[model samples]
Target: MGKVSSAIINTENVYGDLEVAAKASGVPVKDVDVDILAVHTKYMIGEGEIQSVEDLSIFDNDEFFLNPELHIEQSYRVRYYDKTVTEKTHLPKIAIASNKTLTKIRAKILADSEVRYTADLADELENAINRTLLKYGFLIGVRSNNLKNEVRRVASLIRVNGALIEDVIFDVAQGIEPLEPIDDAMIYHYKNKVENADDPNSSVLSVVSENETIIEYVKSKPGRNGRNLKGELIAVTEAKNENAVEIKTTEKIRKEEDDKSIRYIAISQGYVSDEGGVYDIKEKLEVNSVNLKTTGSIEAGLDSDVTINVTESDVLKDAIGPGMSIETSTLNVQGSVAEGASIKARSVTIGGLTHAKSAIESVDADIATHLGTLTCSGEAKIDRLEGGSVRARVVNVNVAVGGSITGEEVYINELNSNCTITAAKLVVINQLRGRDNRIIIDIMQTPEYAKNLKVYTDEKQTLGRELHKLKANLQDKLSLINSNTSSVGYVKKRIEELSATGTEAPASLLNKLKDYQSLVYEYNTIAKHYRTQKERYDEVIAILQKMQDMIFDSKVVNKGRWVELNDIKFELIEPRKSICYVTKENELARVITIRHLEIAGEHIYEIKKSNEMPQELL
Candidate 1:
């Protein structure tokens, strides 16, 4: 018969469903025959076949059909075969091999033979074997007959000769000749003999010579003008053995021998000695300039200039010895500065507290003190001041209570009662309370008036000097005129005598008369000019006197602000006015209403007698 044409059906049912299988195979069910044998073996043995849709119910919906071959070789059968055989045979064979397997074999061989294999050498061997097999064929067949014999020979050689096979294989694969093996014992013996001969190139011999030279050089004396092995100069000096050598240097010496000896001022953490005098200190005693923590007090000798710093709870107890003040160059102290000491320095800073009776004088003073006196020429800052006097160019106080403060500019954050503050230009107080607080701000002299005063004073002095010179000139002129008057009188008397005789006057008398007349006219003219100058001098004197009086009248007029006040009544002394003395008999003083007391807000009050006080007063 001719070839039998059939559709291979892939289905999941045990009984072949021909219609579903035909649909899955894209064929008409009636035109194709059903084959149950393909379905029973899961399409592995043969293609499947199904008869009708009812047959699909017996199969799971998840079951899928794989694409089936139109023609499968049902007559062929696979047989057991070894992959190592490459010769042609009745069965096809597959070779199982990889780089990992070859690497493991190489490692085992190297371990057994006491031989080492680098990664490069191992990789080369693996590549040669794998390349040789892959190039021929992984499956043995008739064309790979010679290759099969070569692989079997290499495997047999490696199994029998072990790692020695690597050398032979490497030489064959890489086209290199085999190297001869070395005798380790004989090599070691020769190496030892060569080292004992003291060759210059040998590291061991060089090290030995170097050690001996070092030992000999250390034992030898350090001679001057000597050359080392490298021909370098070597200097030597004779001296006794000591722990350390001290070389005296004068590079940074600050004082000369003729100058006063230096002294060390130490403020330790204990009670201080009261020995009053300068103490010689061989070395400069250095202290930290920052916040220094201490526990006790500090006492210094008389006339000592020192810089002291302290922190924590400590006080400067002793008096800054009598007849000795801190120098203007040194002397600095910080922390709790106690009383009974007068400190004078360039600058003084108290970080903690400043007690009473501590008279601190400096160019600049900064104190976080409660109550203390500070007299600084530059600037002063205090934290809380009470019942003390502060005089400085600029004063800044956080809180002031019952103190007298005087400065060019005074700034107070809080002002309590009974504090007398005077500033030349400004007095700024944020919160003002309590009664009897006197805040006086002196209005500075106006620039215009100041300039005028300077000009007027200069003019007055100049005019005074001119007046003195003019007075002297006037006196001299008067004396000369007086002498000429006597000459004129004598000439007139002679003229009169000649006229009474009824005779003609002589030429000598006429000449004398003419000369005397000329002198008189000149004297009168000078006297008239003198009177003009005298009038001018008198006018100038009057003007200068007026200017002097104006300058004297230019006084500092005080202005102030009582921002907030308590119920206590206080007196405000008006500027340029005398203090009003209130008494029972002084009715005029009571009647006089001074407009200086200006209440800022709307407050109602009544002026009552000193004896008649209201029970409820606002």
Candidate 2:
């Protein structure tokens, strides 16, 4: 037998050619055998033989090979040689085996162009590989360089998963410059871009994120009725000034440690504590008003005025403890104050009743207390004050009982008899005269009243001196007028005698008559001067009398309102007895007697009827 050459063909049409060649070579056609080898590397490795073709047309020439027998030993040897070469190339074998599986995936990814290979697909591939490798007593080491190279090569043909794509995106993100946050009304779209670093035409861009925001503006879109709502519309605008970003979130998340909820809304520049309290306001904290509903207290720092309104009762009891004080520039409290709580501020006003033992001190304080003491440097207006002392520059009380009130001006609608009142200027009580009430009116000894009295006395003395001088001048004028009148009468009698004589008298006699006539004129002039002086003297006398009356009135009602003691046997404590002004004969007069008076000093005085006075005293 000669050496037979064999040629492998991947098409089924060549099988008939081999049969005809064998028959023409004097070999029997029945000896020709055609074998089709499936071109898949999995089937090519195990048996070194062709598998059966289930469907003839389904097998493509590129995926299947047709092998015909030459019957010579050389053709058989050539077939064995080609199989050995295919089995030794492991990389190409793996690629060829996975090609059909990867073709469908690549086509799917390329169809969308933006489709990303996700981590789930990569995980499935890893799991399948692990399961297959484990059955062969081997494990796929993910960290191996050979596997990494193979995966990169395979991914280049197909599409890498999302995990790798995300890595690339992150790298690009790190290189990008950070952008300033925009707070205006605008639309922004963030895109993922792939650019050839070298070729601008190779760039691709796709949107990754999009955002739209709205802000306030002056002129905005019209409403449904074509009417411009005052503050409802929003317009597109740009930020004018750049400042540090401030994020104000109204949704407050309370800490787990706190047992209560605190809500604070700030409309101005102010600092709110994490615990929901406002303090340390640099400017005046002006809101509609501060209203506390629960158990909370507000404290304004120095120079900050605060107006607090608490509608709930017993809410401030725990906040304002005994001896604890709330101080502010101006404090306005509309709730009841706890007992023994002291408040010191520039101005304090309490709309509710203050409890007992609470001391309030301010420049101007207005409070209603059951038994709280109020000390105001300026003015105090109290309502229903009972069993507490009040000392202020000016005090006005609706009702006072068993409390010592001392002020420059004190006004009480109803004063209990057990209360002691001391006022420098005035004390007015509608209902006075309860037991043991000490009403002390310090008048003459008071510096303010004493100064006024001194002024009055000096004026009266000066007026009296002017009156005496005028009277003296008038008296001299009267005397001169009387003398001139006598002279004038004598001159007039001589003139009449001369006229009756009707003869040419001596020049000396005529001159004497003329001198007498001049005397008559002088007398008339002196009479006119005397009358004018008498009128001035009378006016001065009237003024002097008025000043004397005023001096007496000043001793009683100089700086304070004179009390009308309405038949009440209440003891009056006065600095001087004469300071009491009593009504007698429809006129106000100083007390004259010490009868029925518990006098502290020797100047005690009493009031008496017109008939009760002694004959000499009247």
Candidate 3:
């Protein structure tokens, strides 16, 4: 038979009511006989569901489309399942095996077979439909609408009319679709890194402050998964943002991740940079020079974890601009520091001269040449010092023309300085020149020692007074002993004469002589006590002298011949507190040194000239 389509006769095949559905969907009905299965409903419902639909006169719906074959095959060779359809990234689809779809009418079958229909017949039809769907690898949905009612309604029609009827529905093929990512990851740069380092204007580098945000990273997500009708898993596709810029973090820049994004921040003050998707915050920075034209003043703070290296070596121009101040953890300058500039750091190194008006402060410093104000808590080494005011723990200079230097220990190879020098330990110079120089040895250094010295000095003065009193008492005692010596001899003679004669002498004379003898014994006891007190006084004096001995411990040694002299002098500071004071006025010598000496119970600081120098100072 040729392919045919049945037109409904008054009866409609929509899921709900025939009359209402025809009017709503704009279909012609309620005219032909022997109802034709021509009405098509987009959404299928349970059988006879149209009976209760109250006011569905103007409802609209959309129909999902799927291809159907020309005719239905009912043979043993018919294949119900199509395997060519597969699930895509976000869409899953399957094909229908047959062109026509029809619902089995239980009542029609009963009427044709001359058997009475019961509610059990509907159950049987549903069972059979389920079996068919299972055979085609379909697992969920569709059957939830309950096909029992559909079967019973068809059976009711057959019982009333006593004829078979056809119920048809077109099913659109659908399956589970895989989940897909919606957006891609992105990177945003907050600080633009220098692309070229060789640029001439890069004399002084620009740096980002600590804890500044460098980059913001927006992360991507992978969506959820899905399954198909065949019970197979569908994996989700990850989002790949091709246009998003990628920036990697370096060690100097720490990364912090939150619920949504990752942040790159500079942990130290330094040059922030990005190169080929790599982000870096460099703590070590190199600049050609620091001036108003090239770069502004850099004050990142002393503890900013930054090291700056100035590479400009021109002696004519300043490495640090005038009136500019720099404070960093470490600073190295190859060129001269200009006037009115100030530098403070943990460590400082200068390859060129520091000008007069500039000032530098550091824990430790090394300067090629210095003619400025400098204060160092640690050691300071200078190639040449001239007319500068410097103070440090230990000062070493190759050549000192003129400078006011104060240090615990000062060592100079060549000195033509007319400036004042104060050191606690000693000032040793290989060659001396110029005049108006006053090298002083500072005795008061450590506070604890100084305080103890003061106490001992007071004790020493008291002991000296006690010793003077003891001396006067001992002189009187000696005179008594001298005067009583003749009398004691005469009494001894008288006692011997009496003993020889075995004669009884007067008791009064003997008693008087005996009392006279006790006087010498008493004098002997008092002399022993005086000696002990004198020793104690000497001990106190020694302690006081040791405390003042640092002045003598310090010295000014001019090892080589004096090049020139004009009222040059060397003096021990705090003369009263020192064990001995050294003095020199316009004294010219080849090798001048102050020596501590004891001559005739007197302390002396002897200034002498010699060629030999101390081996330790060498």
Candidate 4:
């Protein structure tokens, strides 16, 4: 009997449903008998034939077969609770039992203690050293040869006993050690901090400005009296050399009223023309050519057309003529601006030329010129101006001087002047209401200007009479209240005297005392009413002052417009006329209602009954 293999069948040896089991097991589903085997086993007291065997192995020649399948396509299945086959790893088995006794003693010691080690413990120690490095988190830096010594040092510490390395020791030597898994947040934060602190040449500049501008300085540098070019580069203006350019405040050229007095006066020269002045000279003059230059003044004399060229130091009076040309580079002085003379100059001096005695005078300038201080003995007129300041005794213009003009009586149609001025009429101006920043007083002429007069006849008379009447009534009431209260004290004393014997006070005396009490209460009421009336009387006097203040503070009033009291409060509500007024107190407490009327004048109606009217009412 050599080792034999056979597929034995026993019809009576089936355990589960044979057909269903065969179908599930991917074998032929035909009803076939399974193999039965007789074995002596502890599970069965009496050994007989075992019913079924789950696994069937059969050998034919040298090949082995598990279960014969009927279907050509086979699907394998296994049933178990959470059946998972363990994957075989190529990692070698850790054999601590090579020196069994020593390994057992070490294991026993470690089990009772906190230390533990595994097959890749040495590799873990090496990785810890690399992990401690701040830059090793970067893939390139970690693989670099820079941290090789550190890794080797950490590997040497992988002994069975490294004095039970405490967390504090590791914290001091290599920072917080990264254990099994590194926390992403801690790693990222530490990496950023370390990189920021380590980079020496890392310099950055940040600027914020709504308007575009350039910075010309920085606060710190690198050496000697210098600073650490570290910290934030907030603004360059704090550090290096300051190269800010300062603006020079030279005179800004503004449009000015023309100042040259070129009147064609007909003077009585040589008895030919009695009124012949510059007009006679102008008839004989001819313009050679009109050439424009920047400097000097032009004066057309009797026969030549004047072309003025002002220089740094030269007077134009001697060199000007009709049709004659004068040219210079720098302007030092402008020719005398006199009547009957036309002056075109780089600048002008009006100090020598007195203003014309004409009712109206006009001056015009095309280029830059100055009219120093114009003293108009009478009156003058001016046209368009480019620049300069004018101070005139009496200045009047056909059009408004667009620029500034300072004068005693300056008349302008359209211009912006910045100064103290006194004019009979200032029609159109903006921000003329004095500003606190600038010292300017705009005293507009009041429409009811007559009311501002200092005549106090009406006010004094009215106030004096009211004050006298109020004082008299108040004094009389005070005297009467004092008399009645004194009488009440006397009556009380008498009643007490009568009741001294412990008997009730005489009825007559009690009646007299009750009368005194009534008089005292009436006195108090009258005193309170008089006080209120006195206060109201004072208010009537104070209202006049408030009305004056309203003329200035309120725009509606200050605009010099007529505003009736009805416009202030549009709707008027009049109390119902004497329709048996009902009041909270039925003990004859009078119900006074206010009735407002808006007629031609403001009036208030009193709806008091005839009996309730004060005896003092007229």
Candidate 5:
């Protein structure tokens, strides 16, 4: 990257067409372009002055043309002579040269309604000239830089009225062609570009259909006045028929009761207007025109722009304003709607469920479920509900359902009863719905402790097996001590008598006495019981741990799509003496015998079955 700067003064050199003037002046000019000759009497002078007699001496040596009225006219005559004739000579008569200069005609113009004149005046003149030139089948004019780039020559000084005057004069170039007017019936495939409507490069104008069928149908209809394609009103065939006119125009419409006349005019290129407003149909009238009487009552629209007249025969269903709602049993929605809540006695109706590609908002009954945005001012209850189910993103209620709940998000304030609930995540306020007509409160969990409990159960089982083997070994040790105790007791009695007699015992005698005294308690009470107690405790801990882990795992079951009581981890609240009325899944299908019960984890118990065995009752 290098910084480069040069003082490059680009002066616009005048390459004017001056050679023709020099040739006409008979000056035998060389490379004399863009030069102008000053007219002096009958002679054309170059661009300088010759003042006195001494100044005239140069002309004597050059053999210049001498004019008799040179002083009278204050001009000189130019002549051609050979060098041999070096004296002052009389100038000859010569044809007067025609003066040629660039024609600089300019006009100030405002580019409002007068924009056409400002831009196309020169073009129009050029067209006319070229049309005249077409007779000769030839074209003339310089293809200058001015007209090459579709340049718009703007006026430098604008008038107080927003008018500007142009400075440059442009001539149409040779070989320029005249453009043909576009055919009204020309087929133009629309490419949908607004900027290219007047493009010089475009051969034909384009048109596009936004609502093609609607436009065509409107066109096939009629306008307010009975005008034909040639815009002439003809006599009507059906005189008795009040004119049922189809309006299509941009112009303001006029309706008069005097002549029963209604006018439809097209003012803008696109829009057409009747007595009501502008329309866009380029067609004639279908219905005849008639006077419409004003209804007595007028009501403003929601926006207050459109005023609708209410007649005596008209019916009013509902009217909604700001902070105003007309409560009705039947709520019909034809389009997409976002609402805070809905409470419909009959049903919430929808015309199109396309927007709900995956879901719809509806409820058949208080219990029967579909997708519904349910809201309750008071307590909401459903006794026997059935259907697919509804899962609202938001569920605010003091409510109860005899149905299952499922959706992406589920939240409830206080749910007193429910059949089934399956959700990804659930948050409840106050109390959650529970099974068997029971209320459950404050269900919270911690992940780490649950994991540790799992590990503890596994380790406890291993410890239990080791304790059982250790207990057996202790039993064998106790039996051996019992068998050796009597022999050892005889040895201990002799040593005790000798020591009491004040005699020193032998080394062999002392060793034998010490060994016998070690087993003197008859392999009995304390040692054996201690080992057995430790084994029992280990076994109890292992069983309890295993049970706890199974309960914890089942309490939060998340698998296999549908979960049943048998599928979850189960513990018996009340133990039965003999298992009867057991199902195929090894679950008790009946209470069998009644007892006070308490269970740790979630469980299901069946009370009665449709079929009963005669032998089971006995």
Candidate 6:
């Protein structure tokens, strides 16, 4: 090839609507078709400036408006570039050749001009070499992606004006060395990726579901011998790898073999563990303790079919260290949990004290001592609680101290410290040893009560007003229609009489008839509106009353004697909270009762003290 260069034919553009563009380009209306890679459009936001891209997605949003004009500058890229060397002056001498068998390809930039390289140029170089290889008996052994990469390297060196690349080895080989394995081996394929522990988002413990593919086994086949350029058979002198091994999995990992291949699946959802080159999915992972050095973050997940057990139980060490989180199907801890440590599972049991800053969420929880945030959907049994937030459905505590307890039903054996207790239906305290306590009969989230009740109450009032107005409006319309009935009858009779004599009725009589018909239609519409609004008002009133009934079912009771110096306050948290009562400075009582009632449109909270406990607060 001769010296080469790339050139653009023209840069002119024809821009306008269909007819205007045809006229500008001097093309006939029927032949005004234009060929372009893309239509350039501008999208603007507000009046400040035009913000757009070649992509039309930017203008797809309703916030951006289309501009009338397109951008003037057109971007261009070189697709195929090449230059032939024509007696180059101070450049390095180029060299290239084919081996005796034509089974190797080692070459460099043997041309002159080279700049930006592209896929087209890479294809040209590969196709030329393929033709030469096809002429002989040798065939290409290097992959297509790798071959193109090497071809582009030639352009890379020319663009940098750098030193020559070594041609001693096969850069893009015509045929790789012919070899065969001495013995066949089993190849195992893992389904999941194992990431490094240092990666913050890395899930070092790969999890798998029951009967899921954890490893696949396929028999390795020996490579076929190759032929040289002269059509000569080549022997397999050297082996790729002489190692041959068989699969050996633990009892937890089940292996199934078919006619085609073999696959190892997990018996249960668990962590992928390996031992002595064998694969096994451990259903239960037991560790002494969880910390940065032991287990960075054990997150097997709630549905991962894995169980985590922390066995360390001394007071000095935490079962789960600071900032450690364990999410599994089942969790058990024998020792205390440290600050910033979290445990989440289907069921959690902590045998030691929980740090104040940590948080635990589970379906069922059993903690010896808690000073952390524990939220459960099922039940919680705590030995001692102090200065932490606990919310569950049914809470049973032996002794509770300075913390907030919320549930559907709460039972505390002894109230030894100041605490805030909120229960939806019932609250029972066996003993009140300290003071400054708030026992609230919580109306919030009391199924179909609280916010829904308020909504229905307001709706009932509005509907009542509307129904009254509609009834008055309907009556007025009916009265107007009745007053014009006789006039309408007289006008219709006069028209009929005139028609019998073959005479046209006066326009005044016709106007009176039409006015009466319009009044009747208006009256019927108002009557229907009044009836619908009255039914809706009755429905709203029923719903509001039902909600109020549910709210009153909640109660708070003190079962044991109230300490002499203790101050306990009872509260009801309805939409409008009501303070039931606050005991005297040195109040003494056996069993106290607090109830909510609405009499004469007033919320009456009654505090009755008795020696007997309230039966409803059981």
Question: What TM-scores do the predictions have?
Answer: 0.32, 0.31, 0.44, 0.17, 0.21, 0.58
Q: lDDT per residue, candidate 6, 454-512, as tens digits?
A: 78777877888888788788878877877877878888899999999999998888888
**Alpha carbon RMSD to native, model 5:** 31.6
Best by lDDT: 6
Candidate number with the higher lDDT (4 or 6):
6
Question: Tens digit of lDDT per residue, candidate 1, span 428-472?
Answer: 555655556665433222234346656655765765676677567
The candidate scoring highest on TM-score is 6
lDDT, candidates in the order shown:
0.41, 0.42, 0.60, 0.28, 0.30, 0.64
Candidate 2 C-alpha error for residue 119, in Å: 93
Q: How many clashing residue pairs appear in each of the predictions shown?
A: 5, 5, 5, 30, 19, 0
Query: Which of 4 and 5 is the better model by TM-score?
Result: 5
Superposed on all Cα atoms, the candidates' RMSDs to the truth, in angstroms, are: 44.8, 37.7, 29.8, 33.4, 31.6, 20.3
Worst 10 residues of 1 by lDDT: 209-218
Q: What is the lDDT of residue 239 in candidate 2?
A: 35
Candidate 2 weakest ten by summed lDDT: 167-176
Which runs in model 3 stand beyond 4 Å of their true positions?
1-248, 251-254, 265-278, 301-305, 445-545, 563-612
- lDDT tens digits, residue span 127-226, model 3: 4444344445443222133345655665565556554334323332233345577555544444244223354333233466789876776666666554
lDDT of 4 by residue, 1-618 (tens): 012211233322133344544554444434332222321111111244332322221111111111111101111121111112222112111211112111110000011123344455444443433222211111112113323443333334433444234221121111111112211110111122222233332211111111211111122232211111010011112233333232111111111212321112112111011122110111121222222222122222222222223222223342222222222111122323323224322222221222231011123222222232332333434442223334344444433322334433454332322222322122212212211111111122222322432233355456567657756766776676577776667777877776786777778767866766665666576667657655665665565444333322211011111111111111111121222222121223111222334578865432232224223221
> Model 4: how large is the Cα RMSD against the reference?
33.4
Give the residue spans of candidate 4 off by over 4 A.
1-412, 416-427, 430-453, 456-480, 484-618
Q: Of the candidates numbered 2 and 6, which has the greater lDDT value?
A: 6
